[model samples]
Target: MADTRERDIIHAFVELSNELVDGYDIVDLLSGWTTNCAQLLDVAAAGLLLADGRDVLHVVAASSERTHDLEVFQLQRHQGPCLDCFNTGVAVNVPNLEVEAHRWPDFVRIARSKGFASVHAVPMRLQGTTLGAFGLFGDTPGSLNEDDLALAQALIHVASVAIINERAASDRDVINAQLQHALTGRIVLEQAKGVLANEGNLEMQDAFAVLRRYARDHQRKLTVLADQVVNREVSGQEILRHARFTSIRP
Candidate 1:
């Protein structure tokens, strides 16, 4: 079991490295990163929050709808592990949410109501600059072991680097532009997901998977493809065709 997990971790890193190539879609990359982190770390779910040019946090990606809503709730209330981690540039490990009620009352209440018992948030920082945070949610109360914690931080660090290196620019203006672009792309991607879901009579997650599969198969940037779908430049029927064929493949 341990060896298999080790292989999975290695494979995750390799896939991340491959996606770091020139002109990769930042939103798609981060979405996949959150999903990979949840699976690799054995967490129930994971979410990623990124700061825009104004340093305001936005929910960029999540492994589950419940996780996404929890991340947004933190931003709305301005208190939570991910928010605190982003502000302080330090990890916030809550092995048990019940124990942190006083620290983040609203966040803890909503998270527990959503079936999450613990959360660990790590900063996506490089050097002295903090970008955002990656949050892991568990269904039961317990801390990630030392090695797992280190691995989580490592993954967050790599993701931060990927964001910075996406355009090979280190200037504050360039970085902020990249971040803003990604956030905007996420909005369009969500609209595209709605379109696919309605057109194909599929769930939101499955619609997103179809969008991703179509994007990857056609060697198209996810954000760009989403934009086309939103603009009607790419017909929903064309995308549904791919989705239906893929689903029925033996």
Candidate 2:
């Protein structure tokens, strides 16, 4: 039975890991983390928090609104395992919330009211940098088994790596697209120069000079104007009408 459960959990793990998209939506990213945490870890519910660029953390996603409410309860009460784990970048595992006397008074009361008997918080972090912490609520008491704890920690690291990888891929795609645009512009400039000289009976050198001066005066890209000319969309007469070239003619 245990082996089958473990396999089921691992299958869910790989599936969610594969769902990771570069530059994923914020809600979808956090929701996936919370849902997977509950699925792969021995917990009844899950919650996720996020730190914005300003370093303030917020409850960004939760498996249920009830979980969101409990997280909000912790935030409002200002004391809980999640806060501790977030600040210290460590896991906080409360085996039983109902009967644990040495608990965060406010957290225990709220969690007991919500019918969650045990709670565990694992820091979602990367390389000593703490982003936030994930919360796991259980219906029974007793600390997680060694395997379960290890799996939770591993998932946190996976979440962090996925986020970083997604951001890097997004940046790379943007740069690659800009480089392609630049090369395309160069080609259009070449095509435009050919058209200008061939149509106006001007030397290639003088034709290029005329094109540059016109673009500069009009505050347009030479490549853009070149595209227009090559397509017969604009005439050299229209372009040179404003300039006096002592040694050049249209």
Candidate 3:
């Protein structure tokens, strides 16, 4: 079992390293990172939260629907382990959510309601600046073993370096603008997905497929297309028209 987990961790490293290539999508890359973390770390769920230039943290990716909601709630209420990790630029290891009631009353309450018993949050840091945080949620109340904690920290360090290198390749203002744009676009995209799903009686994944397919076929940025949907510049039905037979990766 240990050997298998070791192999999985190595594979995850390779996959994350590959995301450093040109033309990689930051959102998709971070999303994949969370998925990989959940699978390899024996966690019930995982998530990534990035801080914008304004120092406000926003959810970037989530490994599962529940974790997604958890991260969203963190951003909404301005409290959670991930928030603490980012703000302090250090890891926050909570062996049990119940024990954190005094530290994060609302967050712990909601997390417990979601069936999460523990959490570990690692800061994504580069050159003294914390770009974000990686959160791991567990169903049982226990801390990550030292080896596992070290591995998680290493992975996050690599991710931070990759993100910083990518941003450094662009102009300062351009990177800031891009980060702000992605932040706003993600919120709009989430709303648009809900609108499309409800309107078309489709699953959220299917609604996202419709939106992604339309954007790819039309040579438009996914967020730009999402903005259009939110602004009523395009109809959800138009996206649904092409959802069938259109398979999107990431």
Candidate 4:
């Protein structure tokens, strides 16, 4: 089992590294990191909290539905291991939640209620600056073994490097701002696709094509137009009405 787990982690690294250079989606990359951590590590769940360029942390992804709820609760309370990790630019290893009750009462309470008894937070850092934290949660109250902790740190380091490298290549002024916008754009695009698919009775591919056409016709940024669609400022029917399809020649 240990060998298989190690192989899986290696495979995940290879997959992630392939997208590190260009045209990589930050939201997708971080989301995949959380999912992979939960699967490759012995953790019951995982989540990622990213600080925008201004050092404002946001819950970017969760490994599962319940994990999402716990992460959301942490964000709402503004106190948790991930927050500490990001703020201090160091790992916060909480082997037992019950012991940390006094320091993070709200976080402990909510985490316990959600069936999480332990958490390990690894900082996503480059040089002296930290961009985010990856959270590993377990249902049992015990610390991860040395090997597991080391593996988690390695994965976190790779992810942070990929993100920083992407930011350095962009024209953006700050890492957090750039990452936040990229993540938000992904969310908006997904929402717009769903709206179009349901309203126009179209497949996901068709809905995306319609969205692209509308953005081009209006000379609007695709991400901005997607946000408008999600906000209902632009309707799905409006995009469907303007989309033009062409046949491909064999």
Candidate 5:
């Protein structure tokens, strides 16, 4: 199991590195990242929050719907482990939600109600600036072991580098613009997901998969494709047809 886990982590890093090439989609990259963290780490679910140019946090990706809603709740209340981690540029670990109720009353209550017993959040920082945070949720009350925590931090650091390295590190304006573009793309992606889900009578996850697969098969930027879907420039049925054909190809 340990060997398999090691291979999985290495494979994940290699895939991430490959996706960091020119014209990669930030929204798609981070969405897959949250999924990888949930699968590789000893966690029930994972979520990511990214800051816009204004430094306001937005839910960018999540491994599960419950995790996504939890992250949104945190942003709404403005008090949670993730928010604290982002603000302080450090990790916040809640081994037991019951113990942290006093510290994050609303967040703890909601998290427990959603069947999460513990949570940890690590900052995605480059240099002295924090761009976002990555969150891990566990169903039982316990801390992530030191190795898991270190691995999570390392993954987040790599993701930060991918985002910043898209533009020159010294160009603050370009960095902010890039981050802001990603945040905007996330909104469009959500809209496209909804459109596809309704059109195909599919679940949101399935809808996202179809969208991403079509984007990759066509070598189109995910955000640009999402915009076309949302604006009705590209019909959902067209994407669904391509997805169906792709799935059955010999």
Candidate 6:
């Protein structure tokens, strides 16, 4: 009976595998995974967790309000099957929450209170780098069958690819912007240094020090003052003398 049910779930998981292309919506993709798993596998609920660029656990998508609550519940407790899978790079298959070493005491207490009798987590990772976990909760107490575990594991692999791909794309955008930002700041700083040196008859390095100090002291970005000086919009008397180089007050 379980085998037949698991096959249906596995087939849908395989069907969803084709949709894991780049640029696919992260929320929608994972939500679909949760929905399909629940319906086909007889699970109570499911969710996928992913680490953001800053490595914070974010519940990207959920199947239901209870699933949403459960994800938050896991994060808040910080000691659950999902965390184990994420940290250890191993799957956690707690078939019966009531009978065990209670590896996830906090998690089990809450899940049991909510009427869930079992839980499972599969890591979304390759070998070294784990991006997150694929979590499952069930109403009846008994470990997920071998077939169900296989299906979930397969689904987890596909989810990892999609997640890693998305994270890479997001990271690329950030890196490119940061490079552009740094390059622009350097150009402006260099231009400001020249203006300060020319006006003060001081060495280029000293001019930079003064600019740096003043910008830091004022808690303002150096680019703003640098732009003004470059455009001849401000004087350099204080700049030449290394006095507090203030911008032209309108």
Best prediction by lDDT = 1
lDDT of each: 0.90, 0.69, 0.79, 0.77, 0.89, 0.66
Candidate 5: clashing pairs of residues: none
Order of quality (TM-score): 1, 5, 3, 4, 2, 6
Q: Pairs clashing in candidate 6?
A: 95-143, 200-240
The count of residue-pair clashes in candidate 4 stands at 3
Give the clash count for each candidate.
0, 0, 0, 3, 0, 2
What stretches of model 1 exceed 4 Å from their correct place?
166-170, 248-250
**Estimated TM-score per prediction?**
0.94, 0.61, 0.79, 0.73, 0.93, 0.58
Of the two candidates 5 and 6, the one with more favorable lDDT, higher being better, is 5
Task: Arrange candidates, best lDDT first.
Answer: 1, 5, 3, 4, 2, 6
Candidate 6 local lDDT, 1-250, one digit each (tens): 8788758766775666656532443433555666687676568888767664445565655555566567778898887888778888788888888875367677777778878888888887643566777788888977778877877777777765554544553464553343344335445656877888887676665665566556545554566666667887755554444354453221
Query: What TM-score quantifies how close candidate 5 is to the native fold?
Result: 0.93
lDDT of 6: 0.66
User: Residue 108 of model 3: what lDDT?
Assistant: 95
- For model 4, name the residue pairs that clash: 52-176, 53-176, 53-177
Better of 2 and 5 by TM-score: 5
Model 1 residue pairs with clashes: none
Cα-lDDT of candidate 2: 0.69
Report the C-alpha displacement of residue 90, candidate 2, in angstroms. Answer: 1.8
Output the TM-score of candidate 1: 0.94
Off by over 4 Å in 6: 1-18, 21-23, 100-102, 166-250
